[model samples]
Target: MKKIIVSILLIFFIVGCGLKQTIKDTAQDLTNNTVALIDDAIDEITHESESWQATLQELSDNLTDEAQSTIRNEVQNLATRTIAAAGSEIRCNVDFLGARVVQALQRIKAELLNKPIPQRNPAICQVIPTAIDMNLTPNRRNKVDISGYDFDNQPLKLYLITNDNQRTDVTHAINRLSHYHLVLNLGSNGVLLNETSSRLVLEYKDSQMSSIAITQPVTPDCKEEEISFSPDIITYMPTHTRGDRDYGGHGPAITARVNIYVDNNTIKAKIYMRARETKSDWSTADGSGVFTIYTAPSKRRILTIVSDKETSTNYIDSGHAEDFFEKGSGELVKRFAFVGDTDGDEAGTRTRVKVTFNRVVVKLKEIGNCKE
Candidate 1:
């Protein structure tokens, strides 16, 4: 009897492991399919029609709450462990597993339903130098080399930008400066007196790259390098006076602002809504439901919370922007946007908030600190 019971327990353990694996595989398939669907639907969602509303509703219903809960729990556990173990720098765990679900239903409801949508500008600037390093001795002539791919050499200008917002044009003063090199006259009388404090601004046509610092070949006291992300804070306000549909029919002009930032290794997004004409209709009809963030491609949901009432912060498990500095690509952060909806501040008032801009990029910042 003892032998038989032990054999049965072993069999059960094997079967249980197999079942767990099957669930993860199924969830991953769901995640991949959802990402493809959202990528294809982004352009189509802009079209004004009722069919979009119905389609989005069906998509939302199909993504049952149980599945999302399961994925979220699994992801949260992994994120916690990964964040705890990550040294050197804290990195948001990349969602190798398909878990985040994009809330397309909220976006569709906000943009459609008889609301005037805002015009989004996707035009971004490209052509920037990848490397800006200078070799120089204090108070002497220095050689600065700037190189990048697909650089338009015609009509290039180099300027010196100081800490107190001063710009000095030194394009003509530099001798033997070519498409990739610049001979800067350093020191008190020359362009740059302090190598560590000042920066070099490179311009090609209308494209510009700012905050190009100098790096020394040798340093006696080198502190730890500081890492930071560019465009530390992003604030967006609607350019048009268009309003969204509410329970009381057409409402006054709606003004919306979205703020996206990364603080303490956590990525956060928040929205502030108010009447353009009058500061009313600040909250949504759903009480604690106002904004949602989805991951790109898969449209996996990252965060959803009550906007204007509270702040929504999420771990960088999924939908976090990375690969900020890429060659050939323009200066754009390709990530997800916050889609919001709310009722007027007054009872019986409902309004929709729509945002079309959803691109984010990441740059790994490494600024050296030297002891004077």
Candidate 2:
């Protein structure tokens, strides 16, 4: 099970870092040939003009010039534009990978679920919300508590599989561990039935990820380390119009999922931020901000988000073009902080932009060696 989890991480990292060109080409050719074969078989059934028998006959015997020309034209069109993108589509295709991994995980998940293994992107990032550890002396209730952490605190529909894979959702649920009758159902006579090894598996319909993380390595100096976070998790504050002196912060107070990457030499983070624009659109997409790495530490410059169409871009050029990075502390401490100035008050005060890092997904203590 440990090896399987490790394999899943390696798979994503390799796919994310980009695969070798030769292997990519081979995979592309294989995928194309596979698709072509499936299409050829299904053509007779779908293309009502030809019967199955007639399709076979056409293959064996000579065909009319129009039919022959159709085949020739189809084969000629499979060039760079058609084949190059296929390999890239396959690399980031986690759904394809998860379908295969789910079969194996079903076998491992039946038993030994005392510890969770999906902390850092398992085949799927599952949050099986559990309650505090318990120890029963006598006359204790038999049940389990779970949370719908991934689905905005909704009731998580799942199966409670027994040691032998027997599952049921008929048990009673309350504010505490949902109670189930143990003695009435099992271990009759003088013996007591202990059903502690049961585990929860998500329903097939609810398997899609709520979001995705975009991670990148911090620097060449640091040993292989990266940060990740979903782009949609940022605060979406509507920007103040250009030349507007001062307006109330009448915007949606959304939180951003900021992922931190820390190593011996540096600490870097990736966050979802909205690009500054008069009217928000593709040009104001959060991803428009591009960071440029430099030789000196902390000298790395981050350009403001560029428009999706590349029509406009806000670059953090001047010393007062306005960007501030702060590390949090004390009782109400936050892991990281970033403030980027958009077109603030004409009075020279920086206005709060459309997005900010209100949530840090990873902590320095989790990585170790980073101090408070």
TM-scores of the models, in the order given: 0.20, 0.14
Cα misplacement distance, residue 184 of candidate 2 (Å): 94
Off by over 4 Å in 1: 1-136, 139-141, 148-153, 173-190, 215-372
Q: Can you give the lDDT of residue 129 in candidate 2?
A: 21
Tens digit of per-residue lDDT, candidate 2, span 1-372? 976775555455445743232223323444344334424534543444224333333432332222132222232322121232123322323333323223222222221122243322212222222321123432432332232211222343444445576656522232322111111111122212343434444342455322211121222332222232323323223343343332222221222333333333343334434423332221222332222111113423222221111111133322223343333322111322323433443212343333333322222122122222
lDDT of 1 at 78: 33
Q: What lDDT is reached at residue 149 by model 2? A: 17
lDDT of 1 by residue, 174-217 (tens): 44332223344553555553544456666656467434654434
Error of 1 at 274 (Å): 91
> Which runs of model 2 end up more than 4 angstroms from their true locations?
1-245, 249-269, 274-288, 292-349, 352-372
lDDT top scorer: 1
